[model samples]
Target: MTDVFFYHLQSRPLEAALPQLLEKCLERGWRCAVQSGAPERIEALDQLLWTYDEAAFLPHGTDRQPDPARQPILLTTAESNQNGAAVRFLIDGAAIPDPSAYTRVIHLFDGNDSEALERAREAWRAARAGGHEVAYWQQGADGRWVRR
Candidate 1:
């Protein structure tokens, strides 16, 4: 069964948090695909992964780039898993695909956005109904994730 995790972003913006998650994925030797609801968000994330850290490198490429299948981390607005990723990250209210296709499915939503919260609720129900293992993590006051 796929393990589904919901990350409610409260203390930090997605830009500040995503790179760290992607780094952890890479550390686990998991190829990852980050799917966004809009092309503009994908474009923004593409640039973010490059300059988020001055010393650390998070190797990634957008789906528009050549050889997407070879990238460790792939960013896109599409549903297709071009990189054969072991984990998939859905952001910006992106639609959830079949969760069983990957080892893990992560949904990152803005806590401040009502629509995003509703979408996350819908996703939680869907994931539970689909028989996938589901967990919710909310940011604590200090900005660390606390599973709830």
Candidate 2:
């Protein structure tokens, strides 16, 4: 069974936590499949993948190598109606189809953006309905995201 780890937060990019998460997965001999199509997410992951590729941190096996064409961050959307994956990190109204396919879901929300807030709520509802483990992270006024 695939295990899902979610990092939901307010106002902070999920990419900030990705390096640490990927490192942890590598430590455990697990390769994570990031599912996102956001340009920012892709760009960040690309750097990490390169770091791993160049042996800056550690040697990366095929499992750790991110697919360039089909970035692990964004899965194929041919099967869904949503233009992008269902993620509410920086936007609103993104839907994740077949939540069961994901072992975990991370919901990040910023109290500042109404769209983000709506996406967060929707993600919570969808995750609950799909019986998936979802994590929430919210940004505090001090400018840090704490798991809520």
Q: Which segments of candidate 2 are over 4 A away from where they belong?
A: 1-6, 10-12, 39-41, 48-95, 108-111, 139-147
Would you estimate the TM-scores of all the predictions? 0.98, 0.54
Across 103-123, the per-residue lDDT of candidate 2 in tens digits comes to 444443445667766766766
Query: How good is model 1 by TM-score?
Result: 0.98
Q: Report the error of model 1 at residue 90, Å.
A: 0.3
lDDT of each: 0.94, 0.45
Model 2, C-alpha of 127: deviation from truth (Å): 1.2
Supply the global lDDT for candidate 2: 0.45
Alpha-carbon RMSD to native, per candidate: 0.7, 6.7
Candidate number of the best lDDT: 1
